[model samples]
Target: MLISAEGRTYRQEAVAAAVIGYRFGASKVRVSIEAWLPDNRRRDVDNLLKAPLDALCHAGIYEDDSQIVELSIRRAGLDKANPRLEITLEAA
Candidate 1:
């Protein structure tokens, strides 16, 4: 996932802090991601994960993305008007 400046800004402003609050330490972790897109847009899950995972790291949710021991990705149907991404990070 190549995040542009605007996208990085959005993640920093909108999600970083929340991820920090929801997470614990710099321990090895497991992550599950579910992205409910707004339309029938084709997206690469691996590519999609790069930015958010980077955001989580920047938020201090973990020391680094390398700390992720197990990762799962799902293209969870479409939510049209309410497209959203759900991420679950747990101690591994």
Candidate 2:
């Protein structure tokens, strides 16, 4: 099965983020994810919208904020064997 995920899973980074939020007394910390949907940039797929959220675990966490994030006129990691999808996270 194929799947896509977005999280600051690195143990140290996640821990540090939590620590910072705690220090600031953020009761309801905001975990925001800014991501690019896809870059099939071939000019042939207009409705090529992908549900990258369906591939994410925290899809419902911010359902009321925004549904998805998308990138345009750009392509990432066309040379690597396994490319990573980047999603920005701001916790707190």
lDDT of each: 0.80, 0.34
| Cα lDDT of model 2 by residue, 23-83, tens digit | 2122222333333334434543223224333223223323332433333323333434444
- Displacement of residue 1 (Cα, Å) in model 2 is 20
Q: Which stretches of candidate 2 lie over 4 Å from their true place?
A: 1-49, 65-73
**Which candidate number has the best lDDT?**
1
Candidate 2: lDDT of 31? Answer: 34
lDDT of 1: 0.80
**Measured by TM-score, how close is model 2 to the native structure?**
0.29
The local lDDT score (0 to 100) that residue 64 gets in candidate 2 is 33
Model 1: lowest-lDDT 10 consecutive positions? 14-23
